[model samples]
Target: MAVVRSLRQYVEPVVFGAQMACSFFDTGLQMVVKQRSENATSPSDPHEDQNAIANFYMIFNMLTDFIPILPALILARIGDRGYRKVPIVVPLVGYSLSRALLLLVIWLEWRIEVMYVAPVIYGLCGGFSSYWAGVIALVSVSTSEEQRSLRIMRIELVYGIAGFLGSLASGHLFQLYTVGMKQGVLLASMSVALYVFCLLYATCVLQVSRITLERRESTSSGIITHNRQDRTIIALLFISGILYDVAVAGGVQILSVYVLNAPLEWSASEVGYGNAAGFLIFITSFLGMKFFTRFAVSDTSMIMIGMVSFMTGIYFMTFVTTTAMYFLARSVMLFALIPMPTIRSLLSKQVQGTSYGMTFICLQVSFTLASVATAPIYTKIYESTLDTYPGFVFTLSSIITFLSILPISVVGCRAAKQENYERIQGN
Candidate 1:
């Protein structure tokens, strides 16, 4: 019974399976968009195809980030009310349905624009914003404050490993179509099937408990005294997270389109390999977290280290014309995934355990809202500079990354002062 209960507590199954499915869906969608864009062009122009692809993704990403706001908020509220599985399971339903639509599009010879509905339904069902927040909230409640960051990173590690394996297989699976079936049919089918499994597992097999306030305050005086400082820290973390998200999102968005054009045009297999390289960062970041935690490094300092790692790597990304240079740039970003999860861990400490769902959702929603502006602006920058210097947007991303570091630096300084003050008080 004890072993069974322990096994039931594991959320990694859903995390791993869902991320694997998403990997297949991502590669499949990109290839489908590329195929449709090329087929629709009157003249065989790579530039036109590139623009079409970029335009499609810009709108696609915008709707994805925009449409989930209200639904995700409602779902988060519900999760905070104790039904944690609702947010996660409902989104899996959307995932299963949305991914199935891609299979239908491929199998039925439907127009590519039909694929846009996927995000609408996905968003309406609460999308990644609610689902991810719910997962984070669950993890936060289950672990102690001291171990929260490492546990969250472990989840990210599982997610990344799943993505890496799925990506390595996706390109070949996408190319495995027969005369009767179309390209990506098998991959999409597998994606839908995996999501259904996740949905069922989350609904039936996974066990979760609602977390209440960690401790009852003996007096309200301590709470009042710390409220202002806590709020400031929370605000700074939000700003830092938003800025970092924008930089990463913008650069990655452009990179997907960039790799398909000009000097380093990558094939489906190469695209999958490139994606795998990106997921490799999660492993490095998790290991870095462990090492730093062993040495008693502060979370804020870890976040700064990650921001600098990304800043340098993205700046280098501006010069990557060959695949070798691209991977080299990626190598420098080994800790890039550390900041966000660490930020979430810090945020969770600022509030009562019962509010974890709402707190996390707010952070996720902020990222979503910020991405609304980020998508189109980055898209325009990429489109405008496609001819002269396509790598310009990456440089712009590098600048934003540097700006993100400032807020985190302030957070680190504040934490240092608090630690010193506590030591002096103890003395």
Candidate 2:
């Protein structure tokens, strides 16, 4: 807002437009992706299919994010004067139209075949945001390798706390006031309307920085090293973040279904409370870095440990037959949030300035993949569970959750050994 006031009139409008464009497109593509995923027949190898679809979203979302800059960033380096604006604007507009169309589906009540559209709409929105863009870019351009996750933790800390609060509020509202889909839709609509105002203000009010061609070429050239280690770490993060995505998208849809039917016998409101409880754990993680860092476990060790703990939490859900037990299990899982920031900071530290965008992109990619992978897996598992004891649905989720940790263990060990080797080399 301040930036706009100092520059030109209606700068806020551009900012707003940029924002609107992102919201519009992000929602749009997500809807289409999910619509397709949901309609596809449940595969025999549900896990494999889930993993594939999830990974596609993960990669596509990230590519839509950082990869969009290749032409502008790289071209600017090569003295392609006119190409600079192309990178920033083209995707923004593309994302916007996509979102608008996606929302239209929901508003129009698209047929049953388009059922998965909502989650995809939500996913695309995340892929095209200032929060996602600026923070990642900042870390890539300015931060060191070791500190990326720490900063990411800070970001996630804010994210966790805010998310936790929102979850609690939403849960409480649903539980307390009996808010359902109709109210939820009204609330969302109001939010979109407010967003319209924000878009106009930022675009019209914000000042733009004029860049010289020579400086643009020089900076873009020196911005990122394009190193192999950086790329490898990214690949690992991309894979790991999927764990989170699957837990999120699948958890919301499938867990709700499972919990509503299980021995826990939680009502809709209680289910909301359960989710809020998990977010509470996420929020507590903000304090984890302060107290837990002294274990002197490096970030990689912590990530490995966190993943194990996270999987353990999911595994415990399988055994839980009562709401009391569910509460107890989630409480213990609070410790797992610590690793989130630790990993995020690791990536942030590795890359500086705009390059953190690359790291951000990696994390987002993992997130998208998780969502895609879980879609079919959830449908298949749910179907199978119907044939067995319905309670076993939760149990199956636990197995998959814990099984996912094996990869993290391998990655963590690799990272830990890498740090030790670097230390030995330094000596």
Which predicted model would earn the best TM-score?
A: 1
lDDT of 2 by residue, 339-372 (tens): 5456555555445333434455546545544555
Model 1, span 1-427: residue lDDT tens: 9998787777899999999999999999988888888899867576888899999999999999999999999999998777778889888988899999999988898998998899999999999998999899888777777788999999999999999999899988999988888888999999999999999999999987432223321122234355445688999999999999999999999999988877888888888998999999999999999999999999999999999999899999999999999999999999999999999999877786667789999999999999998899999988998889889999998899999999999988988898898899999
CA lDDT scores, all candidates in order = 0.89, 0.47
Task: Candidate 2: count the clashes.
Answer: 72
Instruction: Give model 1's TM-score versus the native structure.
Output: 0.96
Task: List TM-scores for all candidates, in order.
Answer: 0.96, 0.61
The reply for model 1, stretches above 4 Å from the true place, is: 210-229
Looking at model 2, residue 329 earns an lDDT score of: 68
